[model samples]
Target: MSTLPTSRPSTPFAVVDRDRLQANIDRVARLAADRGQALRPHAKTHKCPQIAALQLEAGASGLTVATLGEAEVFADAGCTDLLIAYPVWWDADRAGRVAQLAARVRLAVGVDSVEAVQHLASLLGTAPGRPLAAPISPPTLPELVVEVDCGHHRSGCAPQDAGAVARAGVEAGFVVRGVFAFPGHSYTPTGREEVAEQEARDLAVAADSLRGAGILEPWVSGGSTPTVEHEGHGFDEVRPGVYVMGDAQQWELGTCSPADIALTVHATVVSHAGGRLVLDAGSKALGADRAGWATGFGRLLDHPEARIELLSEHHAVAVMSEGTELPPLGTEVRVVPNHACNAVNLTDELWVEVDGRLVESWPVAARGLNA
Candidate 1:
């Protein structure tokens, strides 16, 4: 039997600069504070408890997750307040787990259907059969946040349908606390301003609809790193996860310049063939989420002019520009991944660095907890 590598590998790997990460955290926190908006950064980007703790210590109101398992991971790590931002479907089994989770933390679940609301209410309204941990007061019951489709066209109800959903949640014994949206279309350069505007307009309309339904505590929330800068004043909270560790997508959209990129795959040049340099890192390590408008699989930091023409599971082929000299074989270089969230999940642990020296390692505790 072969043993796994327990220590940092001598070969190249993903490196995270603690200083850069902290700086990005502070900058974004300050920006949200300046706008008087609460910051509950999405933890799905890094999926590391250390990074989450840093964001909280730097003044984040709470953490936002996309899965019930993610919520459980953070809650087990002592995170008191958590928001499951996805419009999750619930049945008897899932609702039972959700009710159990609500008992441990200040929980908020997103709902886009009346059935989901009714299901959650039925679970929360009933008492647990056995105490999982130390006996305490019965759970306060989780809050519900109606998801409004603010141009993401993803998993959310229409802003016009907000009132009906809020009314349903209220009647189902769930407290309709606020509205949430992704505004994912804002990731593109040309769609940024318009999407941000639409997010604001949609959230405002949804909040009004909820208010008309007699729900006064309808907090408006929306965000994505590209559109977060343009978030309007009416939103009570903003959740931008990728700002902590920028990716090539953010770089191309001008959300973060090369200087702000904190996470990169350190790969070695294994071969040079016919004006092309092959790197060791590829789809498996760097991810294969290339935006339709993206230039390549990933960008080579050392040779900004070079294009990664192809990416296989274990190899990346970078075509050097005319008159550009390729680095020597066995040379290591940094690669900015296309999607930071996926890239982080691909690794078991991350290598922390400071001033070019290895400092620490952080386990990807919630990497595969996607349930």
Candidate 2:
């Protein structure tokens, strides 16, 4: 069992168990190594430099971010290698920021279209004309990675069309560093293993197309937390974020067990009337992100049968299972949010706990940097 602090600080606070955190980090790192692939975990999950350092120390090759702001924050924290895994729609101002970051760190940006490559090239003075009107040359342009739509119908081109975009990137003076895809469709109750297989097959076709375009042996990358366990060489690197802080969704999906959860919202039972237990940690603290299949807004850490049926700005209405009694008023409980990424972004700092004792606090340094 994970230890909790003897004296709780306050209600609606986020806490991370140090032992569970380290174990989770080490487990994923080993999984990648055993499969002969590099581990580049997505930092958008925890958004803490402290957690990033732990992942790096566990032999991660680099980190992945969702935006330029996240890349800047991680770079400033001394991360040398980073990849922005989003197809950034660029403007002049954002282009300048990306260029500055590229010069400082080994950065790579995602591209799914020839227009994105051309825009980036024009901004760097490598292409003919600037399309966005405001053109300023920068010292260096980041490397490019073509995103392939494995099965997720979001933000990627067909596997066969990857070469056209990659060839355009090469002609625009950017080194296209292979292809990557996220098996987001794998986050389901079934067919995840098949989705993993499809991810590898899609990435293989994309990599082959890159090879046909004269980009020899392109770096293939695949995997989300749900599909990372599918072993075999369909990728050169794996990026799985939520493995570090197993959430309620992951627990319900059987990706991680209850014992693997490392982060939770520590809330107090403020009321127990009307046969419903009310928790102080609600949407504001736990984050309002529930998938269609999610059982509730969140899950109780100690009470497996409890369900958070309703959520207000400051109250989480939990319905306990039959024969279960509600704790008295002022009782402290832990809650695992449906999505750890959104939950961590909603908080400013995470109280670190070790062996039931209060340790240090880590700031959510990259919080609210969603540009």
Candidate 3:
């Protein structure tokens, strides 16, 4: 007895506006180029090779990922260069996989301690013009990047400790290429600029320390969606994610306007009661990441003032303000989730939209590759 919203692709599907996505790509690429920084956006945000190709076309120097599985996925998809931004803990079994991957593409590994560099050396054998166990070749050794603490304090060494780490890499016959850090502390609403400054200062100190230890030409890399606009001092590269598909957190932090959001969940109204409407897109469709300061789980596109107070596996409870109208059952509403990364991991493909018309689909090839 009810008609479905055919204008919408389907309930609980992620829709990416083609034009907005391209605009985001071009904007970030141009800004980085003008600022003399190489942009190597984290692929963990979109996780789609099509999107990665678009970024490459827009002049991305390389790609960054959070896990080896993601690196494998992208490498198989023809990404020639990638950086595993996380300080990976590799067991003997995973070591083989790392070697196999390094043999194929230009790979970089992040490490914060001498122990990590030692483990990496044992795995990759020796660097160029060196002797090692089993007489392994040099090109298979992945480049080692010392990850220094830049105020987020998640998984990096102190500025003073970077020299020790880089020296250890050099001793182990690994090429210590550069330094990188993630300024996740900028994710808050009020501290974007300050945390970005912290990132720049910390990185500058670490780079200087490496140079003092006789490590010349140390490349510095740092950036995040919250603090990307701030060009950190001495940073030659930036690895920013979530900018490609901004979420509610970025909007709240003033990083981007509503028009800049390229990804949205298209959900249909399934029920309504007492000024509250339920949508078919819930945690299964949208991500379950609620920032400490987030007002709700997601925001409605048309009704920006509404709040998604509760979310289940199959339903999103949207609470409207006083005297606000509710969308009728079977009506479709677009929701911008709180975290685009997690929201994207929940989907298999993104429905591409251009000028209110369905154009194509982009597969999330690296979804569920957390290992």
Candidate 4:
């Protein structure tokens, strides 16, 4: 028989099961390795260096960050190989900062336009008064990856225009590493497989186009949590972030099951009125992201029959389904947020757990580092 931890306390916090997370990490890492591809898990999910380190230990090559600030945080935490996987605009001041960052780590910046590449080249050329030794050759500047649109019509260049973008980057004095895409449309329930297939085809086309432009394309990356499981061959790497700790959205999309949900908010029932039981956690604790298809604000683990009908800043009113008993006052309930990423950003720390034992609290160091 297994013994529960006596030190366990009831607190409203995001609890991460080490075993489940590690299992997921290992499985995905093996899947990628078997395909002769690399797994560069996106760090935007947990935004915790410890979790990122676990991914690296589980055969992940490195990490993909969405912002420069996130890259800096990870770099400072001893992450040498980092990819800022978003198209970023750089002014004179921002360029100086990026140049400084480039000197510290093996960094790759994403580009979506010729103008962005030209700006980055100008930044790399001027080392901001810090010049390398006579023959050292000013630190082989940051490598650039062109963004392909894939299926999400967001920030990427068109698949047919990939060759032009790669040529433009080359002409601007930057080494075009390859191309990347987001494929965010895969988050929907019905379109996941189709979106993943589209991502593979788009990435393949983009790679061929880049090669046609005389550019030696190396990396063809794209992925998100919902579509990662259906990923196809040909891409050099896949970056899926939310698989670390699934949320209500992923549950509804069928990317994760209830047992796979490793994180939840522990809230105490504070009030009871009419036919509803009010919990202390609301939109502030659980995120306010309600997709059109999402069932409710969040699913109550203990009371599956209860519907989180209304959510205010600090209160959640749960209406018990017909013929269901209402939870008494002071009852503790667990809730999975609609979106884990937003919920994480709203909190400063997370309560780490293992087999129902409270182990430690990890700070969200990169929570507000959106700049």
Top candidate by TM-score: 2
Per-model TM against the reference: 0.93, 0.95, 0.94, 0.91
Task: Give the number of the best model, judged by lDDT.
Answer: 2
Q: Is candidate 1 or candidate 2 better by lDDT?
A: 2
| lDDT of the candidates, in the order given | 0.84, 0.90, 0.87, 0.80
TM-score-better candidate, 1 vs 2: 2
How would you encode candidate 1's per-residue C-alpha lDDT over 223-320 as one tens digit per residue? 98998888857779999999999988988888998888899889999999766899999888998989998888988776778778899887999988
Give lDDT: candidate 4, residue 29: 88
lDDT of 3 by residue, 1-371 (tens): 11233464558888899899999999999989999889999999999998999999999999999999999999988899999999998776667787788889999989999888877677566533445645444347778899998887789999888988999888887778889999988888897888888888888889888887678989899999878888645679999999998888888878988899999999999899656899999898897889889999999988989999998888899998888878899998999999999999999888888898766777899999998
Residue 311 miss distance in model 1 (angstroms):
0.8
RMSD of 4: 4.0
User: Which runs of model 2 end up more than 4 angstroms from their true locations?
Assistant: 1-8, 128-138
The RMSD of every model to the true structure, in order and in angstroms, is 3.9, 3.0, 3.8, 4.0
Q: Over 4 Å off in model 1, which ranges? A: 1-12, 123-140
**lDDT preference between candidates 3 and 4, better one:** 3
Residue 70 of model 3 has an lDDT of: 95
Our tally of clashes for model 2 stands at 0
Alpha-carbon shift of residue 247 in model 1 (angstroms): 0.5
- The Cα RMSD of model 1 versus the native structure comes to 3.9
